[model samples]
Target: MEATLSVIGGRWKGVVLFHLLKGKKRFGELRRHLPNCTQRMLTLQLRELEEDGLVKRTVFPEIPPRVEYELTPFGRSVEPILVGMRDWGEKYKARL
Candidate 1:
């Protein structure tokens, strides 16, 4: 649907969401997961996801400070779709 696409569509957004599906991740961890994505691209995609209300960002006040990203319940609603896509992609690759 156009609505879904508008929120999740993009070169890096889906990938970022996929990683977040595993659990909360710090920014550095996400960067490690998506090494090919430029930091700027990832930051932009995360900002959009946050603005869309599908992702949550938490900032902890500490000596060094901490930040983490996790999916909102609304975001988790897409898990089945994302999981299906992942499964299909695996099968398709195997068939190649």
Candidate 2:
């Protein structure tokens, strides 16, 4: 449990993972999704997730290079947990 939290416990890490579960997203898209998160903080969180081997960063060579973020196979393994959390939160929120 500690290990799982260590990797995904950051303020926005799990949220990032949850969004990525939907599909690959560009940096701008992620920023839009996490509007409350500071750009620097999100950047830091992404770097940490990438370092932990849960997310993959791909850069395309182009005039205006494109970068996209998606989950690695290992990252996809956390789908159940993220989904469960989302479900539970929804239920809990409804109760309030």
The sequence of per-residue lDDT tens digits that candidate 2 reaches over residues 1-96 is 999999999779999999999999999999999999999999999999999999999999987999999999999999999999999999999999
Model 2 vs. true fold: TM: 0.96
TM-score for each candidate, following the candidate numbering: 0.92, 0.96
Candidate 2, overall lDDT?
0.97
Q: List the residue pairs that clash in candidate 1.
A: none
Sliding window of 10 residues with minimal summed lDDT for model 1: 77-86
Show how many residue pairs clash in every candidate, following the order shown: 0, 0
lDDT tens readout by residue for model 1, 1-96: 899899988888888889999999999999998999999989999999999998999999986999999999998988888888889999999999
**What TM-score does model 1 achieve against the real structure?**
0.92
In model 1, state the lDDT of residue 3. 90
Q: Rate the local accuracy (lDDT) of all candidates.
A: 0.92, 0.97
